[model samples]
Target: MALCEARLEEKARFLCRGRNPSDATDLLQDTYERAFRAFHTYDRNAPPLPWLASILTRRFLDMCRQDKRHPQQQLTESLDVPSEEAGPAEVWAGYTLEDVWRAVDLLPEEFRDVVRLKDMEGLAYAEISQRLGIPAMTVGTRLFRARKKLKELLLKKAETGGAS
Candidate 1:
């Protein structure tokens, strides 16, 4: 439990990256509670992080489906915010991890998943391929494309004063 608690915030923040922070917090708490209840069933011999991640991914998907039923509950505001009095570096520093995630969300679903798993979640290409059920080579390809796309988008946004 102590170990799980220590990593809970990071796991939740990753799962909720593109979503509202409040909702992300709620989802994280719910995931923790669910993990607690199911702790006994967890295989001690198995790697816990991947197991926890599988659960988190499922829960996030469930929440996404539920959110679809209530469109009004979704955040419609543009995630990109202009830099105020702050300089570019300051504004960049002010950008939340969530903001970076919002940029990630702008990616196509396949690309987004690969980037999240590889870069954010720190999963190896083979692990990501297995988890996402894609070929390892495909994982590399997708990750390359995703990075390129994200770079383009971020650069464009920065130029337009839309991203810090």
Candidate 2:
């Protein structure tokens, strides 16, 4: 317990490497709460820090999976819809979520991983590099190229009336 407590902040930071700022607090809290609940299941012989880190990682992955499966929709409960003259919709309105998913899937395997980690999983380049065993610069470069390829694919789909 002492060992796990000492590494709480570090573990949280590790989990937050590429995620949204708003999620940091929740991730940290969840990690601690879970570790506390599972304390009895921990192996005394194994290193505690690593075990705690594993818990944090699992929690983060679970969140990502849940978010993917049930994406949150914008709530209209608090605001009136603006008149048509107010403004045009967002630029990405031309592409549906399914279209974006298909375009990402069409990317090469390597590029697809980078896109999924950085864009979908919201991982930081350093964290992605660490996970993939590549340099941070490589992660950045791959993400940039992946985005470019995805955009090109989406544009082509739009032109061909293939966007779903």
Candidate 3:
């Protein structure tokens, strides 16, 4: 546990993203418990944060499923919606955040970086350019392309009932 304590804040941040902030502690505890059971499987040579993060992400997804809440009512708040229009929100209501994240993970590395930085981390174009060492115009271009590709991938996933 000592080795993991310092690395948990990032997991907590990930847990709270687009999720109910109140559940962060509970989810973190649950993930820690899971990690404990699986600790023996971990190789000492590898870094722990990525393993812990993987556990936390899967734990959160499992909790969402076990609770029977995804695609029910939580969708109203989980997705990025981007606007007040119920049309887009309702279309997204059937998908869970995990489903969205899975699609994001499928993007090319550079596109994924741009999307995560801009959307998930809430970085402005200028900040993203500075961090990524790319032109601000390139940031906008990547974000636009990433979002358009994301829409296509998500639509495919939606057609397959999120199995894609």
Best by lDDT: 3
lDDT of 3 by residue, 20-137 (tens): 5556787778878998999999988998888888888887778766444333234324344544432355457676667777888999999999988766766768999999999999
67 Cα displacement, candidate 2 (Å): 14
Worst 10 residues of 3 by lDDT: 69-78
- lDDT, candidate 2, residue 164? 50
Off by over 4 Å in 3: 1-90
Query: 13-58, model 1: which lDDT tens digit per residue?
Result: 8777745567667877777778899999999998777777777777
Cα shift from native, residue 49, model 1 (Å): 38
lDDT of 2 by residue, 15-127 (tens): 66644444667887898799899999999899788877888889989876765554322111001122343223332455566667777799999899887776666676788
- Cα RMSD for candidates in order: 10.6, 10.3, 12.6
Off by over 4 Å in 1: 1-96
- Output the lDDT of residue 73, model 3: 36
